[model samples]
Target: MGSVVFSIDAELGWGFHDYSNPPTDRIESARPGWKTLLEIFETYNVPATWAVVGHLLLEDCNGIHADHPAVDGWFARERGAWRDRRDLRFGPDLVEAIAEADAGHEIGCHSFSHVLFDDPRTTRDIARAELETAIEVARTFDIEYESFVFPRNAVGHRELLAETGFSCYRGAADPPESRLRRPLEKLLATIDPQRVELVEPTVDKHGLVDVPPSLFCFRFEGMPRAVVETLAEDPIVRQAKHAIDRASRTDGVFHAWLHPNNLQAERDARRMESIIAYAAEKQATSDLRIETMADVAERAQ
Candidate 1:
């Protein structure tokens, strides 16, 4: 049988720290969705890889970015101490909840501070520091990360990841030809969502399993939002179910990923539930197997 892997980019505000005006309201609004995700996975007995930011596991920080590299010539602005920004910066409680969940989820690293490893500014020292800090912080919770998801999906520093004991990393899907291609594709998806390509996990030169993503559970907004919401069904759910079915028939891997923050509205959560329920149903009948990124990596090895 084929397999399906779900990976959640579980970074709170750290995902947007580089933005001039971070969406504080949206970030806070999505906090509850994290717990909702755990509950949903429990309901379906579906485990996922939660690639958490290292900083989120911290109780407090000095509110400084002196150790990390500067992105685009400016360092990440720390408004105040981490204590005051607990909702955004610190989330050990949320990480603990994922660890305590009954679904047997895997907690992996998403860098220390969402630093883009692919950027030229991110030197070897910076990359090493990020991985080291992430490993150190996760150790406090008795968790040893074996899966690494690059920040912003801008992959880099593979040797460092393998040296740090990570066995696998998620790779991006096919790149769009142009910037406009993505927005245009999103709009077109509202009409008829395409089936995502399935991949077989491959072992790279660095000895890390490359579990590339099949699709991103993109959130519709603006005009596309209106069109999607008015539709009789969810295109995202339809697309995911189709991909899962195709994977089962082809004996390939279907990997679906999204941010918990994407579950902003009730409808968004319902869409996720629909996709997971479909995958679980298929698994119950031996059509498809739901596995974590670590499981794929282990099997690939």
Candidate 2:
């Protein structure tokens, strides 16, 4: 029985900085935000999944420089930042630090370059390669990870996930039926499982775990707490909580996710802190287990 999964996708911008390589951003640097989050989580003694992009797994910055620097999407270009001026050997240190601090903590994959899965159906080959590269990097780091969360929550390529030896993936959350759509939902008489499906850890015939990440809402740094409170009251949160709680009772798994960058935004720390506190406070210990997407998939198998 699992309680709830709290995971963080620590990653870079929309995609790889360079067409032929990955981002060169110092994503792992201990900025004020990272320090604040780490300190808070440490004090609270809460464990979360840190899913790193593949580029973050490497010790060297092989692809970031004046000759080539990650400017944007997986295949875009950008002018090199000052840090990029040095040898392209700046990334993944933050990931390594987290691994060293907590052995029970898990490292999952966010693809090699934070490849977007949303449309206008961006590059499919890049998505596959990013997924595959992330897997390879995870193995090289000896994490043996089985869970994947797409960058920006974009999802698709379910078959490719199964083929890549991943047991589970965190897909998009389903938007609850709007007030205007209530009549339709009643008429339909069923929730669209594909839109917000959560599966048992057991692998499919092809051996993939499907964990749908249904986000309630998110707020930036300066955004008021009133907004999230507004969200927590939404029937959707209660419904989602009930679903997860029931899963705990039924020997099924539950998961939820966030991103580190969300904390980097202005005034976002206060907003996210409230959420972290709420999630930590509401964490159920009953027949419930808390795990990262990777941890849940491993146990499911």
Candidate 3:
């Protein structure tokens, strides 16, 4: 049986503050998306890893926030902008709901303020402070996060991750080695499955398991109505199924991931349902196993 590691980056507004059109009311926009996603997971009997932002675990970042002198200046304006608007930055209720849901889901850390680990400005001390604060906060909420997903998928301070006791993290998808196919792969990867051969989980230099993603659960809602409807029909869905088949046949891992905000639209929700149902079918007939990042990390140990 091959493994399927599914994860979701669960950061309400923190995930998209760098975007041009940040959500006006992040919590409200994220609520329905999370509600539908959990339902889909339960219905499909799929266990997912939800890598939550540390700040969202609290109702507000009023009292116990650690000060990172070096990194504080990195996103000063962005963070300060949302300081007064708790709804745009926090989601303790969402965290509580996920904890209560259980539903075979694993909660992992997504950092305290969604700091990009790969940013050159994020120093070792700053990274350590971020990781430390996230760990401390998770402990307070009783959320044992053994696996991590870097903010914006910007993987950095990996040695720090292992040092601070993380067992696994989602790495970038492997690119094609072929000069002729590399560009094609890059373009296709955004909308389809292109790296099935390299989707297998491997250990990093620090011995932390690297669970690379196979395909991004991309957004189609932003496309024209016709384009959205056409994509909803099969192109994207077929690629997902193909990846699952390749993984099952080769005894590899196929990890699919997306942000919760990706599910905010009804059309996108229904599209995701198709992918989940297909995975369930693969599990039933083929030797396909549904596992979380934590599960893979534990087995690796």
Candidate 4:
């Protein structure tokens, strides 16, 4: 049996702080849709990894925000633009809900304030503070984060994750390499449903394991409604099925990920259910083990 890991980037408003709209308008918490996700996982007896933002653990911030060492603030703005808007950042209730999910579900780190580690403006001091603060805050809730998912998938500071005591991270996507016409390869990969290679968990020289993802959960943001509806097979579902098949045949790992907020839309939620149902079927019939990212990392050790 192959392994399948579901990683959720569990940040509410903090994940969408860049927007001028109040986080309430753009982001959501565990109350409405997120609770349903927990219920679904419980029904299927599925385990997942939730890479929670550190600030969300704080019991309602009374005008408290991270004192980032970077002059530009978290995003490098001179005046902490979103600091006073505590409602947009704090969500301790959601943190608790995730902790109380499936007994063996993993709680991983998604940075303290969704800091972009790949930004050139972000210094080592800033990165260190972010990582350290996440660890410190998680401790308050008694959640020791062993796996991490980089904010916006901007990976950096590998040694820092190991230093901060993380066992593994979700590495960047791996596309098939091609020597034949590069542009054609890109177009084909984009247009066709092809099998993506399942990542074999590998340990870095720094002792941090890389448990990369196989495919993304369904999202319909960029495509037009008409095009999406007209497609013979939902692209995301097809991709996920292909990955699952490849992994099952090869005894590989198929890791799928998405954000809690993605399920705020009913369409996205249905797509997620479809994917989860397929996963459940694979688990019952195949040796497809559905595990948390930390669980996979532990096996590698």
TM per prediction: 0.91, 0.66, 0.86, 0.85
Report how far residue 4 has shifted in candidate 2, in Å.
Answer: 1.0
lDDT of 1 by residue, 141-250 (tens): 99999999998899899999989899999986555652456766646744455536788899999999999998788644556665766865777787788888887777
Worst 10 residues of 2 by lDDT: 216-225
Model 3 off-target regions past 4 Å? 18-28, 63-66, 70-80, 173-198, 219-221, 224-228
lDDT, candidate 2, 1-301, per-residue tens? 5456667776544233433543333333223445566555665556777767776667655343232222334232323432453222234666666676642567778777665667454565656777767777677767777777777677767678777777787756554453356655532322222233344444555677666664432411123334544555423343445555565566655555656545554445554455445445556445655667766666667
- What does candidate 4's lDDT look like per residue over 1-301, in tens digits? 6888999888777787655554563365434556677767777778889898887887655333457675433453213655665555677777786677664688899998787888886788888988998899889988888999999888898889998899999987543353354865554554455645577899999998999887767433445434755866666777777777766667789899888776766666667777777888887888788889988999997
Cα error, residue 243 of model 2, in Å, equals 8.7
- Give candidate 4 misplaced runs (Cα > 4 Å): 19-31, 62-67, 75-87, 174-191, 219-228
- Error in Å for residue 4 of model 1: 0.8
lDDT of each: 0.84, 0.56, 0.75, 0.75
Model 2 ranges with Cα > 4 A deviation = 14-31, 62-75, 78-90, 118-124, 175-205, 216-254, 265-285, 299-301
lDDT of 3 by residue, 1-301 (tens): 6778778988777777666666655445665788788888888877889998887776554433547644445444345766676765667777776777746789998987788888898888888988888898888888777898999888899999999999999986444453356754544644554534426578889989988887677632344434645655545566677787876676788788887777656767777788888888888888888888988877776
Question: Any idea what lDDT model 1 has?
Answer: 0.84
Q: Give the winner by lDDT: 1 or 3.
A: 1
Candidate 3: TM-score? 0.86
